[model samples]
Target: MDNDPQAQTLIARFNKMKEKYEEVERFGRYHPDYSTIMKEVRVSKREMDMHETIAAYKIKETELQSFLDEISQIVAYSVSDKIMVPMDGALFKDGGCGCGSGGGCGCQAS
Candidate 1:
């Protein structure tokens, strides 16, 4: 990993949060279940909705953490590769990014 302090802190936080989220999901999956019929169900509808909401949020958080992990990997590799470029050029368009054609900037205006 790169020696950058900010990157290290972010990666650590993301990893910790991701682990906690996984634990919650595992608990939900292992919880006991019961069959239901036209008579009635034990769990309240509102309680079920809340549980579903929490599960959805956990799923999204895990996905975002996975993306952050991939970015950290790329950054570490880039530092080792010694490949560098101007920040501005890497981010902003140079206005002539495309010409009168059907590709690039797609400015054919046909």
Candidate 2:
């Protein structure tokens, strides 16, 4: 979120960790501050991923991707009579829902 202060803070903190890691990355496996900074960077990344807005966005993004994939299959089925359809059948497959729209069709393909 462009205007989200908390997200901005986390991003800045993560960037700082990146810079610190760069300073110590040349050291071998036992670099003390490198591990600490890397751990902090990972934690910061997880925090961003778990943020409420970001988490919701990711869920919706996944659903949208599924819908898009279903549509792509549906389009191919329309042109191929199922010949070009992937083995991973969607509702567009025969005896399936025949509708890619997630409209609570109550069909098993859903």
Candidate 3:
């Protein structure tokens, strides 16, 4: 998507419309151009989201985020103390990420 002309065009259009929307918003709801600019913003956003490559990328991004969140809960990767929290029951019983050597943060459970 980095070098795709269509993606770049769509992104530029969306960003331009978004900036316009923000500018109009500061002028309050009574601004005459507010409605028109808002519509443009919505259209550009929808156009970008409906693009095949962008849509697929977004879906994969969401899936990866969900997987990361689940991992964070099941392991101690996101914890301050590196203590693994039991998901359903428990993941590590050795305590403190279960990294037996105390080598680093996070669990080493295989």
Candidate 4:
């Protein structure tokens, strides 16, 4: 299939969002007492909402990726079953299907 510009853009946006979420996670991890941090940083309700949005986006992206991987497998197999098996399919960029040969694209499941 041709490279999808929109999908690529979404992937990039998701990566950036994931990075920002990681920063938030680190902040929370380092300072368990978030009330003090929240007061110091003046974190508003909207800021919390933004974080939640980011998290929801991450979940959506993961589900989308998994769906894409499964669809790719079906398409490939439809073209030629021997060309791609279910054991060779993965939903993430780096994961194994536990098959001996590692023929999959290495996409981890969602």
Highest lDDT, which number? 3
- Report the lDDT of model 4 for residue 85: 43
- Model 3, residue 98: distance off in Å is 36
Clashing pairs in 3: none
Give lDDT tens digits, candidate 4, residues 1-110: 02545444545555555555555667775656555544434433334335544447667877886787788888897898777544322434445544555545553334
Could you tell me how far off, in angstroms, the CA of residue 7 lies in candidate 2 after the best superposition?
2.5
In candidate 1, what residue range of length 10 has the lowest lDDT sum? 33-42
Note the residue pairs that clash in candidate 2.
Answer: none
Pick by lDDT: 2 or 4, better one: 2
- The C-alpha local distance difference test score for the whole of candidate 1 amounts to 0.45
Each candidate: what lDDT? 0.45, 0.70, 0.76, 0.54
lDDT of 3 by residue, 3-93 (tens): 6789889999999998888889999689899889988989999999999888888889877866775787766755565674444323443
TM-score of each: 0.29, 0.53, 0.67, 0.36
Every candidate's CA RMSD = 15.4, 9.7, 11.1, 10.8
Instruction: Supply every candidate's count of residue pairs whose N, Cα or C atoms clash at under 3 angstroms.
Output: 0, 0, 0, 2
Best by TM-score: 3
Q: Rank the candidates by lDDT, best first.
A: 3, 2, 4, 1
